[model samples]
Target chain A: MKFSTEDLIEGIRSGNKRLIAKAITLVESKKAEHRQQAEELLKEIMPFTGKSIRVGVTGVPGAGKSTFIENFGRLAIANGKKVAVLAIDPSSAINKGSILGDKTRMEELAREENAFIRPSPSSGFLGGVANTTFETMMICEAAGYDYILIETVGVGQSEVLVADITDIFLFLKIIGGGDELQGIKRGIMEMVDIIFINKVEESNLQKAKTTKLELKRALDFIPAKEKGWKVPVLLGSALYNEGLSDVYSTIDEFISLKKKTGSFEGVRVQQAEKRFEYWVQEYILSMMKKNNSVEEAYIQHKKNASAMVFNPSTEAKLFVEKFLSKGPD
Target chain B: MKFSTEDLIEGIRSGNKRLIAKAITLVESKKAEHRQQAEELLKEIMPFTGKSIRVGVTGVPGAGKSTFIENFGRLAIANGKKVAVLAIDPSSAINKGSILGDKTRMEELAREENAFIRPSPSSGFLGGVANTTFETMMICEAAGYDYILIETVGVGQSEVLVADITDIFLFLKIIGGGDELQGIKRGIMEMVDIIFINKVEESNLQKAKTTKLELKRALDFIPAKEKGWKVPVLLGSALYNEGLSDVYSTIDEFISLKKKTGSFEGVRVQQAEKRFEYWVQEYILSMMKKNNSVEEAYIQHKKNASAMVFNPSTEAKLFVEKFLSKGPD
Candidate 1:
C-alpha cells in the first residue's frame, strides 16, 4: 500500500519477482495514491527500461495466441535468454474479470525457471492491450529480462497500440481459415513485422504452406514501411513445438540486424517520443475532467444550439487559449 | 469557385453535377474564402441531406474494391435508385496519384447515366477515407442521390472511420487467398455489417462457399451488435455481377429493419453528431495552428520538455479553456 520510490526501484533492479509483480499491480491500480506511487516508480526505473526487446504477439480469439506464446517463450529461454510473457486477457466490463478463465492455459511455459508469465486483464481500453502494458514492459525490462513478450487479445485496436510500443509485432494466423486472403485490415497487417502461420501441424501443414505462399504474394501488393525488411511469413506449430527454434533465431537476427544498423536505438527513440505524446494526451484528458470547463461549455453550447452541440474543435481551441494565457507550468 | 452559396445550393437541388462537384471541392479546399463559401453552401443544403443511404465499402488492396463498387453501383441503379460512388484512391506520396487507377478502374460505372463516380485521393488522412469524404457524402446526398457509396482504400485505419460515417459497412474479400481468418483484423470484422466473399467466380466458387461457412462459424463466437440481425456472409462475383441482387436486398433489409425500429433516424442523428464532432476537432486544430500564443507555447513545450511534450488531449483542454475565457463567439 505504501512503497517508497527507492524501495520499488531496488526491488525491481534486483529482479525480485514478488516485488516487481507488486509494483506492476501498484502501477495498474486506479486508486489515487497508487498513481502517485506508480509515477515515482517509473521515474526511478526509467534509466534501466530500454535495454530489453519488447515483442508484441496478437491473433484472434481462437488463433492459438497463448499456445504460440508459451512455445515461443520456451524457445527463447532454451536459447539461453530471459523471457517474460505478459498475457493481456480481455476483461468483461460488467464483472471486471478476465474473460479467459485462467492463465493456466500457458502453464507449461509458466513453470519454466527462465520464463515469467503474467496475465493482466484488459480493463476498459478499446485496444486489446491495457493502457499500462507499455509501462509494465518497461518494468519487466528493468528487472533484467532480455525479451518481453506482450500477448494481446488480438480482438481490437489495442493490439495496434501494443505493436507501436513493441520492437517487433507478430501477427498469428491459422492456416486454411476462411478469412485468409479475405483482406485482413491493412492497418494491422501493415504494422506487423512478422506474420506467423500458426497451427501448422498434421492436416494443416500443407494448408499452412499454401497460406504462406499466398501471403507472400499478397505482401508484394502491400507497401513496405522500411526497405529491406519485408514482412516474412513463417510457419510454426505451437502444439507440436515445431519451427519454434527457427522463429527465435529469426527474432535474434532481426534484433541484431536492427542494432547493427542503429535502427534498434532509432526505434526506441521514436517509441519514447510516442509515449511522451500519449502521456501528454492522457494528462490533458485528466486535466479536462478535473477542471470540468469543457463539460460546462459543452452544456452551454448544447443549450444555445438547440441540437447536439459538443464541438470538440471550438471547445479545444478555447481550452488551449486559456491554458496558454496562464503562462508556464 | 466564386459562385454564391445560393447559386451552389440551387444548382445542386436542380441536379447540376458540375455545381455539386464544385461545391464539394470548395468544401474540401483549405482556402479561407472557399471555407466561407462551403459553410454557406452547407447551411443552405443542410435540409436536403440525410435522405440518402450512405454505405461504406472497404477491403484490402487488390481486393477489387473499385470493381466491386462499379458492380454494386450498377446494381443500385438497376433497382431504380440514383447512386453516387465516392472512391478514395490510395495515394503515393512520391507520385501523388492513387495506385489503383480509380477513374480507369471504374470507367464503366462512371459512364452509366444513373451512376456518378468521383475518385478522390486519400490525401494522407489516418482513416482510409479523406477528411472531406464526410462532407462529400453530404454534398452527394444533397444532390438527390438515393444511395451514396463511400469506397475507402480498405487497407488501413481509414476503413474504420469510413464505416463510422456510413449506415452500413460492406467488407469485401477474395476467396482462397491471404491469411484467411487469422489474418483479418477482428475489429474490422466486428464493425462490418455485411461481409461479401467477393471474386466468387469460376475456380474460386467452392472456396468462397467454404470461406462463407467459416466466417459464419467465426461470427457465432463474437458478440453481435444488432440483436437478431445476423452479419450475413454472402458470396458475390463483383467481376461477373453474380449475386448482386442479393447484396442489394440484404442492404434494403437492413435499412428497413432499422427504420421499423426507429434506429434509422437514431443512426442519422448519431452520424450528424459525429460529423459535427469531426468538424469541431478540425476547426480546433486549425485554430491552434493560427493562434500565435498557443503556437509559441506548443513550441516551447516541445523544446523545454522534449520528452514530456503536450499531447492532443492536453492541447485540446488548453484550447477549450482559452475559447471559454474569451467569451461567447
Candidate 2:
C-alpha cells in the first residue's frame, strides 16, 4: 500500500485507523527512504495537529497504569471525545526491546471503536521515552484524536521528560507502602500536576485515605515549583472503577481553570520553547560528531597528557580556535 | 596578573590558591576569550586528573548537606587526604542567582588547610550543578585533591545527573517525621549508593535506627538498578558528627572492593566515555546553531503550519536532512 501525506492527513481527519497506524509506523521507522516519506506525510498533517489534550501517565512497574488508563479512556469516550493511547514499554538495556505489550494490557480499550492504541518501544534512549514519541503524539493529534494519552514505563528520570512533552502530568502510586516519600526525589513531585493514589479498593481503602492525608501533609513542607497551581492528591481504584468520575471531573475543572487563567496556553508555549532548545542542542552535537574536530582534539589531548608534555588546557583552546576558524561546512 | 595556561598549570600543581581560583573562573566564564583560555587550561590539566574519588551528596533543604560535608571533609583530611568541596547553591527563579553561600555554611572546612571550598551557582541549569562543574572537578583533582565532593541542591531527578557524574551517590534525609520515607521519590533512591538518615542525634537516634531498618526492607523490594551493589541505609547525625567515621569507612570499603575486583577502573572508563559523549554532543549542537539550520527550519515549519501547507513531521525530516547534509562547520 502506497501512503502519501494527503492520504494520511485525510484518513486521520476522517478517523481512519489503518492510515493512522501507517503514519505512526512511518514516523517510527529508521530506514532512510521511509524517513523522508514520513517527513512529507507530517507536512500534510501539520495543520490538523495541536487540537488535542496530551496527558502523560507514569509510575512504577506495578502502579496499575493500564487499568487507570482504561478507566480514563472510557471516561473520555463517554464524554464524546475520541481517545488515543500511546503506551511506551520499558526498553531492554542490552538490545533496546520493549518488554510490556500494551495490546494485551489494554485489550478492551484496543477494541473500542473510538480509540487507537500504540505500544511503542522506548528505544532505551535518554529521558525515558523514545526520541520519536514526541513526533508520534503530534501524529495522533493530527489524526483527529482530541485526547492523547501517553503512558510511559515508570522508570528513572525519563518520566520528567515525558512530563515536559505533555499537557498534564499524572503520577500513579499505590497506597500503604513503606516507600520513602522523602526519598521520592524532589524533582519529579514538583513536576507533577496530580498524584493519583491507585488501587483504592477493598482492603486498601483505609490505607489509601491514610496515605492521601500523609501526602497532603508532606506536600506542605515542599515549596510549590509551579506558579499558581498546587499539586493535588486524589484517590481512585482502577479495578472496581471507583472514583473515576471524580477523576474526570477534576481533570475537566483543572483544564477549564487553567484555560481561564491563560495557564493552558502558557504551559504549551513553555513546552514548545523547551522543544526548540532541545532540538538546537541535539543539532549542534550532531554537527561536532560529523566534523571530527572532537576526535582530533581528543586524540591530541590524550597524547599530550600521557606524555606529560604540554598541558591539556592549552591544547584544548588551540583545537577550539582551529575548528572555529575553519568556518561553517 | 596575566594568566596563561602554563602559569596556571604550574601554579595549580604547586597548590597556589590564586592560580586554582583563576583556573576555575576561566572555566566558569561564558565570554569567548575566557572560554578559549579555559579550554586550553583543561587540556593541560586533563593528564593530572582522574586520581580523585568523586562523591555526590544531595538532599532537600534543611537536610544538613553543608554540615555533613564539613564533618566528612574534616574526616577525610584527618585520614591524610586532601578534599575539595564543590557546593552548588540553589538558584533563585527570579534573579537566577544562587542563595546558599558555602563559605558561610562550611566556615570550619573553609579554614582547613587541606580542604578546598568552591560554591557554584546552579544558574537555573537542570543538573543543579554548574555547567563547568565537571571541568572544575578536573582542575581540583589536578591540584592534588584526592577526594572531590560535589554537593547538589537536592532537587530530585536533576540530582540523579549529579550522581551520574560521580563515583558514589549519597542521599540524605531526616528521621521519624510523619511518614518521611513515603515522601521520597523512588527514582532517586534507585540511583543512590548510600541512604543516610541524617539528624540522628540524642532525640532521633532510635527513630533513625528504625528508619534505617525500614529502609533496608524497602530497598529489598525496590530492586537495585546497578548490578552487584545493594543501596546501604545508614544512621548519621551531621549536627553531632556521629556516624561520620562509619560513613567514610563504608565509602572506603566500597572503593577498595571495586578496586580489587577491577570495577573501579571499569567505572571510571565508563564515566570518561560518557563525558566524551557529552562533549561531542555539545560541539555538534553548537555547530548546528551556527549554521542557522534549526532557526530556518523552525521558522519555515511554523510559517507553513500556519498557512495549512506543511506537516511537522515532514518539516522535521527535511530540516534534519538539510542540516546533516550541510556537514560540520
Q: DockQ for every model, please.
A: 0.08, 0.16
* Worst-scoring 10-residue span by lDDT in model 1 chain A: A304-313
lDDT of 1 by residue, A135-189 (tens): 7877888898989988776555667677667888888888655747553543565
- Per-residue lDDT over A159-206 for candidate 2, one digit per residue giving the tens place of the 0 to 100 score: 766777787888888855575353353355656778889887867777
Q: B4 in model 2: Cα distance from truth in Å?
A: 4.5
TM-score of chain B of each: 0.87, 0.86
User: Stretches of candidate 1 above 4 Å error?
Assistant: A29-44, A59-79, A89-117, A125-130, A170-246, A254-277, A291-329, B1-26, B29-47, B55-130, B149-280, B292-329
Cα lDDT for residue B131, candidate 1: 68
The best candidate by DockQ is 2
C-alpha lDDT of all candidate models, in order? 0.68, 0.69
Candidate 2 lDDT by residue in tens digits, B190-234? 667888888877776777777887777556544454557777788
**B103-136, model 1: which lDDT tens digit per residue?**
4677787787777767674364321124677677
Q: Which candidate number has the best TM-score?
A: 2
Q: Model 1 misses residue A61 by how many Å? A: 5.8
